[model samples]
Target: MQRRTWVPIATGIVALVFFALPSEEPLRGFLPDWVSLVLIYWTFALPARMMVGMAWSVGLVVDIVSFGLPGAYALSKAVLVYLARVLALRVRTYPLWQQTIVVLGLLGIEALILTLIDFIVSGDLSGLQRWTAVVVGALVWPVVYWILRRARHLARLGH
Candidate 1:
């Protein structure tokens, strides 16, 4: 099979693992948004294969598996894909530090959107803990990118 095929399979595996991980207080509220990161990463890495529709589908799957509010995560992920597309090329050129900053900002937006949804549905404000995931996600972006980038290269997906 072509490497391009492996990319999405790898992403799906990662996302499932991400959702499967048990949340444990400080960490519970702040574990890096793993699926979100994978969604964002692959969306930008292979826009042709990963786009808004795919993000929505994956988000819905995550919501179903995680028992989150339906459409909340799906919508937020679609929005993130739009934002990532807007900055996709720019993200590729930036240094790892800069890229991490951008990922943090995107994750922040995702958290903010989810928080708004939580307020609408449950009237609970996530407070500062909602941002913990953004910070953690940003810190891990380079590692995720490195591994995925190598996979992309091996798959002959384009530079």
Candidate 2:
């Protein structure tokens, strides 16, 4: 496969690995939403290559890996892709710091969708603490964006 094909796959796998790693109760919430961050970065950086269907598939993998509600993550990720696609052009122009705000909003929406699904399926809202990851993800957006952007340049994935 070409670099375009394998690079995203490799990055996605890394995100999933980070997402799947075990953590202590106190530290778990601090782990950024690596999967969502990657999806957003790719969506912004390569709008034509990253589609809603692809996001859904990645979310499904996340769902399976996390052992959550079957379609919860999938549905949320699909929605995230749709929203990201709609805002891709605009978001891409912003400086990385400003883009961090947008990323926070996007990740928050994903969290909302997951929270709603959890409520509907299990009647438990869990805790507000779960949102810590959203904040962490926003703060980590620059790093994620920089890393992926560097990778893209390294691979010579020209727009």
Candidate 3:
């Protein structure tokens, strides 16, 4: 692994776990996309280092843990990172509310790609769960990004 703060690595791992947890509760169908959300936050915050390959690697780990067509998430995540990388500067410069909207679009695109891949693999579209994740993630981007931002900055200040 490349040299970087453990904060993000830990956050990413936690997000993956959040993704895997059973969402059987009411409205849980719209479990926020913790992994992608964190990835987007890190990508925008540290655009110089969070490259497409990093996204690919994270997706591969996810695929290995999650049961599905391998490379499906890898591709979707890489696409998300690629888009984020392209828009990192302008996106980061925006207000948090505006940035959330941009991230929502990216998350929706990633969801669409993943849903399409799922349909292609299983011949049926996932109902609600996929899109719901996008909506939920987008809705929470600001709070998660804000918390992570503060956490990252605080750690730096402590050191």
Span of 10 residues, lowest total lDDT, candidate 2? 1-10
Instruction: State model 1's lDDT.
Output: 0.81
- Tens digit of per-residue lDDT, candidate 2, span 1-159: 246567878899999999999999889778887999999988888888888999999999999999888899999999999999899999888988889999999999988998998898889999576598899889988889889988887776755
lDDT of 1 by residue, 60-155 (tens): 987888888889989999899989988887788888888888999999999889999999999978577778768988998889888777777877
Clash statistics: count for each candidate? 0, 0, 0
Among these predictions, the greatest TM-score belongs to: 2
Clash pairs (backbone) in predicted model 2: none
What is the alpha-carbon lDDT for the whole of candidate 2? 0.88
Model 3, which residues run further than 4 Å from truth? 1-4, 157-159
**Which ranges in model 1 have alpha carbons more than 4 Å from their true place?**
1-3
| Among all candidates shown, the one with the greatest lDDT | 2
Question: Which candidate, 2 or 3, has the higher lDDT?
Answer: 2
